[model samples]
Target: MKKLSLLILITVLTFSCGNKKSKSESEPENITQVNPAENYSGTASITQGIATTITEDIYTCDRGRKTDVGEISSTDGKTWIVPAKTHYLNNDFPFATDLHNSCEGLNYDTAEEALANFNAANTITIDNDGETYTAYIFADNYFEMYVNGEPVGKDKVPFTQFNSSVVKFKVKKPFTIAMKLVDWEEHLGVGCEENRGKSFHAGDGGLVAVIKDAQNNIVSSTNDTWKAQTFYTAPIEDLSCVSEEGNYRYSKNCSTEGGQDGANFYALHWETPTDWMATDFDDSNWPNATTFTNKTIGVDNKPAYTNFTSIFDDPEQDAKFIWSTNVILDNEVLLRYTVE
Candidate 1:
């Protein structure tokens, strides 16, 4: 079924995501930065970035959701994985996390370490003529970023643990930023994970970002202005609860009362367009991103987020956490915006 499919021309970036490895070393500087585009060695086919369709009948929370990769871990294994009990990454996710397995991104031992790594002395040469800017970002699970059709970098950890990042990149004005956002799943294509007390609990996702120039002037941030489209949705109790008007995909009416069982629940998946990450991709007709609050995203306690409020939650920046209409049910989402 070509459900909610929209075809349009978009112009860059390599879409073969999930290529970056998790960090196991302490020195991120010594760790090589991998270009996600290089991971795709296949020909430029229509299905290059496409997602496979999933089939299952709509089910209630108690019935359990359908999944192919079953039980990555038991219900007890499903918990919010944070590295420390208190504040970490007090400055920002300045580099790829060395812990690799921990949900935390990058951490600095002291203020000097963080400043030395992220301050003005630091430089990224992606585009020679481009100015340097720090992209402070927080996401529920994972995100891969592209600037002007080139690789910026992907989250070191792709799934399960909540993580954040501050990518230092150089890009000229009028550049396009494309990000592939995945909420990550322990239940695989079903989009549910074991967490809290439920084995088949449905997890939510949110992405917030703020960009600043050398002088710390706000350049861009996540908001309703950006275009967002959901690629995967699950734990749906009723298909009738979902609807679409033009580009606005709606699943807010679906039930989120995840019961212990989700093995027989339904999910929806769609193929991504080949050039959806291109700089010229026409997203004018796409629905505007839906914004959520810190409480709504449940980021009130995560130090990965609370530690960076100076930038991400700055009143001057006024950046907002964003996601597809239904943050709880939507798993994979694509976001885009051009910085003019």
Candidate 2:
């Protein structure tokens, strides 16, 4: 009898231990997944991340791919373009150039109007603060220009050449801009210091001012395309703000492991203009918004970790939503939970 009682007690304790072990292993202890219930736009608020100095000594693989000029990044230059040696003498290059000899400041209603309207054909201004400017329509032979109305440099410079004299110049409050543009044959043997590696065709040749700032900084620039190269055009959009084109959205998750319901929550926001609606909003498209474990599986087949989805609907705006995960918060940082 004593042996049997001892055996029974042992069996009971063993089963209890087994049950406890099974329960502990059935649920994950440290991992939680969340799904935001909101739709966010491209112009969402961005907080500054951790700051660190960049140097050539720290050669990280990812950072090495991007062009680095001083501390500024070429990939991040929405306001500037890559520095090139040669540029267009005519208004053919996009809306980037601010000066050039080929631009005519004529066809104005008055002299005051003439000063206001720099480029005659295009709606562009070359010398904005200049008091007096000259323009000439010429055909054939070569080209050149001199500041303050006289040429200190060589004349009849061929279209195949580029002039370094066409640089940024700012003198006092008001100034005079004089330019003489000529067109001619392809091989005039004229040379330019900047156009050593560059080539130009006779038909496309024209005068263009390379755009730069007062500090000699290249604001907007482009170089000649290779003979074998192809060109594609992209429409301009605002950089400081995000575009509402396509289905644009952002998301994040917040969860806990020891809550009463054993789950967490999330928030979502987006713009739903009359034309663009979030009715067709697809959450599965979001890479990070998936549930951890499918509840369709029975408990015995389920993984130790299971996450629930929480979504948010807008209060003021019709196109906003907030989402979150439903996970029991254990003895963790649940009290400090907050949404961004």
Candidate 3:
């Protein structure tokens, strides 16, 4: 009986040891391992100490609307994965209360004239204390901005449903800011309006902008303080004529060539300025910019603009006509501003 008990105890001890060893050996060598940095197969670059990687090709409109029109890989988790059919606005951002137009009234002398005034450009100049400044601008069609004759940037999107642009640059005490605005015309001759004839639609134009210093103080904006001049004018002539298409009647005779009339017709009545965008350009004779209130559109929809009073005092005057006397015949306008 003693021998049997000893044998059983020995057998139990061996089984326990075997089970412990098996359990220990079955455990993983390491429970956690660090993942290696992903090897991205895309364009990578460092600019201004900021690293940017573009994993997939992006298509952008001339005005800077970005769309992912290329293949996206799921193999690398680092790639920015956008859902299928995603649309991106300029700079991959959204804005509010930026939509403004000078021709919302459409009661101007002619549709072309309304569009031209809306297309007019203004240059605003404000003295800076040698500090960094930022600017935000938006136009009906489009605008190109320059600081001291150095191109800063232009409107990302041109035409209706306006998009705003932001630019930052260092400035001296007194600097010149110039902008060229254009009311994009589908037909070089006729403006963009709805249902003139076949595709004869004429569109209006306008521009509003604001600038701030490093302290975030308002320095400049689109207002009466800026000077403006029309460098291009078209379509609206003193003479009136009917189009062969009979889709719409013209307030001016756009029949430059026989059969090439109506929407396809174009005529220029103004001359462009020579190097008007230069800092030294003399605009002493230019008229002050007319203040127009964007009553049709407000901050509720266009939040990008903050200084409503700079354009108009009364919100009820929205969509009211504000333009120079020559707006009816001018197509292209040059604006000048010198920092005081």
Candidate 4:
């Protein structure tokens, strides 16, 4: 009887130890898994067993092939593309000559608008007062951004159906933000009239940007409150009517010597302020920027942009269009902004 009791006790203890071991083996251990999509647009976060986040960079351009400049990545946590260079001049004599000769070496208010045709650039100085901020910028054709006179970022493509760029920077007290915007034209001076019968052949130009602080507070944005000026205007000569009754009536090569109808297409010539980008420059004379609502065409095509609504938070600020009297005719315009 004593031997049997001892055996029973030993068996019970063994069973209890086995049950504990099984429980320990079956229990789930803390593990983290991250799976990112192939074409990730922005950052994504996930918190599973141990809380983890995964992110990737991706960019797509007109060609659809992954070129070095079109790559969007986050390997070093700072990934961006500089705007591609587009050919704005052709073999045209007077226009091309004047552009290359007169516009060279001039310190344009905006880097993109330095060329006297179809481009505009401007700078804005902000007193961040020791704060961190992020900027969202986009243009019709292309744009490059600078912070404290340092090139921080630029748009990926020179021209597209539509696109935008985002950048972040930290500054103390006072900082400078400069941008170069270009309105690209395929045929130099409005496409040849021979190709298409469209009256308005000139391309449109616009630049809209917004800045926010680390706390997600709005600091600055493109609006009438900003100061703006014109740096370049192009295709000033009006097309002369060579023949009255033919498909080839208009001639872009006609001379503007005689006092003809629409002889002067109202070209604007101005000297760029030497210190326009400086904080102490006087912008009192500069006109307040004129704000125009984005045309219906851009908004209808939703898939072409990323977070269009978020960047353009205000319905009123949506697709803010900046131009002269006409989009095509007044192709180049310089805009300036100062933050107090």
Candidate 5:
């Protein structure tokens, strides 16, 4: 009877041990960290995924493809187009030559009124006590000017009815002049403006400046001597036609010849360096500014430029309309020059 009792005790203990082992295996010690009511069968790593918010900024256009309107991206520029408040004249800088056509709903301060209402004290100062110089500028659409790495002034008009400006600034000689020139877009990244009953017509970009010293002697002008780099190029039916050997963003291999097929065309973009306007920024690798003729840029009909031919189109020390290799296709260009 004692032997039987020993066998029964052993069976009971063995069963108990088996049950305990099974119970321990079924529920892990780490399971207590999970919510009691939750049924998580597996462990998977979690993450905050990339943002998918839709944006039309040409600078960020690489993340999203252009969407269709009449052609792709017609509604895109509204996000990039500065508000009407951008229309106000920078007081010290008046229009040497301004708007030729009436841009409805926008108030234009004429050259006469701006010159008469000019404010001397508020002009931007790179060197407050330095020599005063005048910059005569004409851009196809827009420009932001920098003198020796300081913000001197920007185009009163961001994008629109063509205008030219004269900026008076106090800066020392050997100053680096940097400009961001944008060709206004009807389509954002694709760089096309609607015309000729086609929704995707490509537009051109040009910028010219003549800087004169306080003595009224021309010190510098936009020409092939300037360093130019293109950050935005577009209306490309095929991208293989474009390439960059160093800073030479070549789009010349492609045809700027097509008109209507830009509906689904592609655009190329690059992030502009933050210190691009700084005096010490190294641009020795940048390509020479490609010069464009008045006829090539189609400036004959635009009085803002034509009206000031003596300055911009001067026969003696002419400031060439400079852009990237393909003005018709390159939309946003950065130019740099040093007046030593």
Candidate 6:
């Protein structure tokens, strides 16, 4: 089954949401900036002047959103990675709420150091010829272009809004993409209005890219997913089952098994460990449906995995199950994956 996958599209940056507009100072300086263009060895070349490339490939909190990957290239045709972060400078700001600084991850101290660190990081390889063209990159807030070792482009600042600031870069051949991150708040100013004194948590940040030709014809694109360092813990649900004539398994649908209209379902195939048995299995001890709580529940994405287990009696025995999001109450269980 094709489940709705997560995306890292939006930026963790501050937002201008809500009806009441907060009177902020003239938008602060763009702490983010891309250096001059240089030569590189890939497919496209920086024939004229410098070609600075900006991308939003950082991680974010919002999942399943669309993002952009700016088009840029170097003189040698080599692909260069852009570095980004939440806050470029070390400026302390208030959080959105009175609780802990909602902004969890921000501030990449010392721009040069952060840039150098990013440059030294591994290079991303993008290969596509048939249908799917894909590239991988890890950025924070914004991206700066560089070729071979020289840099390029104007001091490009990524947008603070969720899905803004999607620039394009020109590429043709296979090349290495290196990148770094910056803390945008350093120049933008964090939580100035209502969040005064409230600690703002650093937002999830990263990169965004789209496949397009030199003439600006879009080919394909990648979506966004959670970018912050937070972890996701999946919960488990139980669905008891009855065996058929000679078989020891059964199948049922989720809606028929007590699932509600707004109920979020996740199906997983579980097998009893070799040491355990369906007869010896204690439903109270293992994960159950009630284990899932604090839900933003609704039917959206499909379950990541689904199956059954009969292994408790014999690990080597072949245990099978028909997986599905439509679960049977007494047939199988659903796992609730939560973010920590």
Choose the strongest candidate by lDDT.
5
For 1-340, candidate 1 gives per-residue lDDT tens digits of: 2332322211111233344455653336655774322332312111111123342221112233222222122122231111101111223323332212233335543322454555543445667888887787777766777787666656655554455666778878988888878776655545667778887678888999888887878999999999898876777655556666766677788888776766555555555677878888888877789999898999787666776677777776679999888899887788999989
Ranking by lDDT: 5, 1, 3, 4, 6, 2
How big is the positional error of residue 49 in model 5, measured in Å on the Cα after superposition? 24
Task: List the RMSD of every prediction in angstroms.
Answer: 22.7, 28.2, 23.1, 26.3, 14.2, 30.7
Pick the winner on TM-score between candidates 2 and 3: 3
TM-score to native of every candidate shown: 0.68, 0.18, 0.49, 0.49, 0.68, 0.22
lDDT of 6 by residue, 147-236 (tens): 212222211223232221212233334322222223232111110111223322212233333333434333432221111110110111
Give all candidates' CA lDDT scores.
0.63, 0.22, 0.45, 0.43, 0.65, 0.23
User: What are the clash counts of all predictions, listed in order?
Assistant: 12, 42, 22, 7, 0, 85
What is candidate 2's lDDT per residue for 1-340, written digit by digit as tens? 9999999999999989877856566867776552121222343222111112232221112211211111212112222111111112333332211121222222222223323544434322334563222222111112332333323222212332221122233222222222222222111111111122333211111222222344433322111110000010011011222233233221112111111210111111121222111223232322221122222211222111111011011122111111111111100000000001
The number of clashing residue pairs in model 4 is 7
- The TM-score between candidate 6 and the true structure equals 0.22
Tens digits of per-residue lDDT for model 4, 206-260:
7777777767666778776666554433333432222122211122333323222
For model 5, the superposed segments whose C-alpha errors exceed 4 Å read 1-117, 258-263
Error in Å for residue 206 of model 3? 0.9
Top candidate on TM-score is 5
Model 1 Cα shift for residue 161 (angstroms): 3.7
lDDT, model 4: 0.43
Native-referenced Cα lDDT, model 5: 0.65
TM-score of 4: 0.49
The TM-score between candidate 2 and the true structure equals: 0.18
> Can you tell me which runs of candidate 4 are displaced by over 4 Å?
1-129, 173-176, 189-200, 237-271, 302-306, 315-319, 323-326
